[model samples]
Target: MTTPETFADLQIHPAVLQAVTDVGYETPSPIQAATIPALMAGSDVVGLAQTGTGKTAAFAIPILSRIDTDNRQTQALVLAPTRELALQVAEAFSRYGAHLKVNVLPIYGGSSYVPQLAGLKRGAQVVVGTPGRVIDHLDKGSLDLSHLDYLVLDEADEMLQMGFAEDVERILADTPEYKQVALFSATMPPAIKKITAKYLHDPVEVTVKSKTQTAENITQRYFQVSYPRKMDALTRLLEVEEGDAMIVFVRTKQATEEVAEKLRARGFAAAAINGDIPQAVRERTISQLKDGTIDILVATDVAARGLDVERISHVVNFDIPHDPESYVHRIGRTGRAGRSGTALLFVTPRERHLLASIERVTRQKLVEGQLPSVEDVNAQRVEKFRDSITDALNAPGFDTFRQLVESYERDNDVPMADIAAALAVLSRDGAEFLMTEPPPEKKRERPDRPERERPARKVRDDLATYRIAVGKRHKVLPGAIVGAIANEGGLHRSDFGHIDIKVDHSLVELPARLPKEAWKKLENTRIQGILIDLKLERGGRSKSDKFDKGDKSERSGKFKPSGGKPFRPKQ
Candidate 1:
């Protein structure tokens, strides 16, 4: 039989084909073209394809076509290596089968199991989950594969590499022999080969070779910053870096919202999108990005799959990806169709190894990025302030304000320049026109000296010390503290000063007078699964020492957005 060229030509259900058409996909990718037909024939199939090769749809479309949605007994099971991928696959299934009203459930670690248990009880036709979570459900007798019609092991190589081989086998052993299995992997290692040999019965093989190289038209660079200071670094880059529109890639769904909120607080038009967001909202946000309503999008890896925006001039890896494939996938979001794009990576000291792995995999060395100096940022601010002035001069309805200023100048016998300077200060909205404090100099590395012997970080006077109830005993790290504070308090690195970890607790330096809401959130924030119980240090002088004890309606301080027009995508 001749192979099908279009998705409609395949044996896909009309609903699935219609959904594909709605997504503007008329042609199937190589992997999709090959694997979908084989799976539709009720044959076990093994697919070899790299990341971003339409592998998810390759299996999802066929699986959805064959789903007995009316049965609603967990007919299909897809095993993924990570929570993000599981959510991605679940979302794809949901989208593809929307017309058929197929129920898809995604379960993973680091999330509450109550929802999963409830979902399983409510009944879903398709269940996509991580190996560990799948095994957990199997142990609890919540997942039954006895009547499963389709079994799929997506990213099988990554699952094995992440030490889930035994869990994969355990799940495989529990499934009925009649289940049609589909295993997809980027490479054929012994571990993956063994799983296919023992499990898949007369499986047809499909291999889709990658048609393009990694980041050919992309310029890549990395900035080495401490964990707590990543936000500070990111802020400086946003101020000085030249880009039309940007997509910041973070690791978690919560981080997407957190980072986007922080960016908005700093006067950037930003939005967050993730698997947790409703599909309608996600689509609307993407549409806004395309129409230049918002210039920056904060997203997780899975949430950004299949995203194609021609105006995205920059891609920022706010959190370095876990694998090289993810790094390639992220950078590929920009620099499309022979266009040049820039990819920036933020690397902490501990994540240098991951950076090295990515460099080796991509066969390209990432140039070290130079953080914009204080003077550079000040110059950018000055230019923005100048533009604001020029805009006021050209805009109507400013005649009254101009006359008022003129009268004040004449009445006080003040020079026009001095009057203008005073007015500028008042018009700044509490943001500094010039940065006074320079960033701390990076410490020199000494291969000859041990880490314990390095000099202690200097504390700045602007920062007030607070104590948190986590330390070495709790196995706390600086990154954990930074992530907890940034994610929970919505505070950035500029709001932090220094950290001194002790045995039972740790001392962290923060803004002397924080907003009441932030203080309350920080007090209850947990690090390493323990409440931080953050408190102001005794004898410390500040505008308010009564943490969370003051009037709830009042706030002591807030970070101010800089004066400028919100960023817009270039036409």
Candidate 2:
């Protein structure tokens, strides 16, 4: 079969093709070129491709091309590993099907069920969700898969690694046997092979290997920034950067607008574009960007997919992407057509791992970027102010202002320098022309000393205790509990205190006051397919007493596997 060059050659729906054109994609990617035709022909597909290889569009375009928009039954189901990826995929489907009025819903844990239930009730043709939440909705009878035509398991390897294997199997069991399943994973492990062997029916395999290197024309760098200081850091960086035009990539639609609004308030000519924006408005925004009406454009990854503008000399990843493929795509927006460009990534302390992942995938180490100091910003402002004066002196106008300054100095017997300083202050409009020294960093207060140095038996009020329903019988380790909570609950290791595993349950100490987001995530957190059912233990036996009086049987360090085999611990 001849490889298709353009999206128009793929026989996609006109509406989807137009949307793709609006996004500036003229040619189909290798994955899309190969996988779309197979999916459209009613064949189960196994796409072996890395993230950021346009996998979403490969399946989404074909699904949209064949979807019956008139039938509101859930026709397609896409399962992703994380909430962020689910949301991203849902957004892509929505953007591509905007003209068709397709309803795409994203369901995930760590969020309220009210909206998802309502969306399902209203009948979204396409449903995207994490495995756990999808199972929750399915068991509740809110999600119906009887009419499912397509099922896509994206990042299957990552999902399996995150301990969603059993959940994935359960979901697959619920789907209709006749459904066309498309499984996309970077690496086909033994487990994934087992799944394919048992489930998929003579699937067509398509593989696309990305260049394991970043573009040579782009200079990559990153700044370690805290969440609260991101806006300040961005403004300072913009003030010092010498780029003609730049694009700031954020993770969500709301963030695109929020960042753009903040940038505009800081005197930048900025605009925002996301999937929610109308096609006409999006086109106008892109046109403005190209014609130099806007200098900084804040956009999401989907919104910036096919955008190619020569004026864009810089790309700022305001929110680090969830995967390395996305990082490559975000930076690729700049340094296009063999032009030299700069890409800046903002990595919060918690996102250092993601930064490392990008570095490993791109095979290029990113230089650490330093935030402009207060002195540096102040100096830039002073230099710009002096240049403005130089330009005014050379201009033909401003004669009246010059005469007034002279008259004021002569009449008041004041030095011309004092008059000029007073005028300069007025020109600043109540804002300081030079910044003051930054405030000192606040020290975190600890009671009695650090947790490590403190006595383990000490029960501090700052640490709250919680209980979970997995223990030695389940072969659950303290590290497992910590890993589950830290990854799913979004809690830091320091946020956890002591973990004491009992025969059937475990007790853990956490901060007394947890962030609202973390608290929500913990509510739905699971360990080895069992919901933790986390509940605060306000009145329990003292932890020290419980530790001193341990159960003899559990202390023997012996356990039985679910297969009824006695397991002995290493000495």
Candidate 3:
């Protein structure tokens, strides 16, 4: 078998070839080389490749080649798990199909429907959207897929993991049975295999092996800290680490903004990029990163897809990802183009299992790193301060400033060293040049109470119980609540405790020392389209009094329970 060296070797459409050339894609990735030909041959494809493996082009190229420009009906429909991925895939289609007269539209939630409806009315040849949004358009009859010839599921495993299996199935069912189906995923779990078995017709399976493990040319390390101390640990690390550019990956969009805000408050040049940011602003953020205006980018996984910045010298996993593949993808943003990169993962003590899983997947043992001590931070700060002074001494127009300083010293009868010291202090603007000493670790004494006699009514010392409005009546399951809270609060599964589901509400126990920001996020978050209405339980309140008799007016008007009735526990 002859391996194709270039995209043109696969006999791509002349227009597509031109677009690919314009985009500077000199050679196709292994997945693209293998899958594009198979797809262009009109065969169903199952592509197994990781996130950064160019899977979008693998399907987009062939889809663009086969699209009928004269027929404006939707010919290809791409389903992605998140709006970010959907927009990215749509952009790839538009970019790859630029030379060809093809219309591509991206329809996703969190955006107005007017443009999507108008695009569908204008007859886009390719439509990309999330499963739920796609279903909405289909039900409204705004998106006509009766003539759809191609269906592609990008990140199929993520879609399933996010509980989109039913939506995906329904969307697939709506498509023409004879239409070619292509499913691309990082991993082929049993669920994805089942989807392929049911929907694909003798699909051509193409697996692109990742050539490099995450550990290759990357210095991987982890810091074990309690949840409350993660922010302090991260800030300390950032102070001492050497990196021209860095990316900090958080789990939630809210965390991205919160972390970015905190970093900025500490006088760091940081920006947050998440799904909520407009496409134009996101592009500008990336551009600023590449051009050195921004040194730190705090982002979520979905928002950082396809981000390739040569200057990114470090990747910080501010929050451990849900899966090992996502960890790989996050760190892969750095250590590119034969450059060495540093990846620091912040793992709470309870999240050690996830850390172990990542190590197992990367096939490298991560070195447990310590937080930079106060002394270390002070030394670095002093060194940088001296360097700044040295640079200023050599800069142009320094003589005039020096003359003014000398005149002041002579007039005030102050020593030259004192003036220099005063100027240095002024330069720092009264900010602490050194970190305060970390508090001594305190040993907890065990309670004298007998283990068997411990009060059942009392909450566990390590667990804090909270009440939520959604429960079985709202079709809320324990797993659903856990998933929502964990994702929203940027918490690990172990961070939660027993979940008691009542008729109209649920009680969940989370880590007692959860940060105030995380608690606020959990309170404001929603599950199953209803606000969680989460509140810390007070002592001596009857369950009925807490749920049924709660004042509805106290809650935010933005979110309400399904019915006008207040939440009530089962009798």
Work out the TM-score per prediction.
0.73, 0.69, 0.78
Off by over 4 Å in 2: 6-26, 67-71, 95-103, 110-115, 221-236, 248-311, 317-322, 336-339, 345-360, 363-378, 391-407, 426-571
- Backbone clash total for model 2 is 0
Over 79-149, each residue of candidate 3 has an lDDT whose tens digit, in order, gives: 98766677778888989988999999998754567999999999999999877678778889999888999
Candidate closest to the true structure, highest TM-score: 3
Model 3: worst 10 consecutive residues (lDDT sum): 552-561
Q: What is the Cα-based lDDT of residue 186 in candidate 2?
A: 96
How good is model 1 by TM-score? Answer: 0.73
Q: What is the lDDT of residue 93 in candidate 2?
A: 94
lDDT of 1 at 227: 57
Best by lDDT: 2
Model 1 lDDT tens row, 32-136: 888999999999999999887899999999899988878969899999876667878887888888788788999876566799999999998899987767877
Residue pairs clashing, model 2: none
Steric clash pairs (candidate 1): none
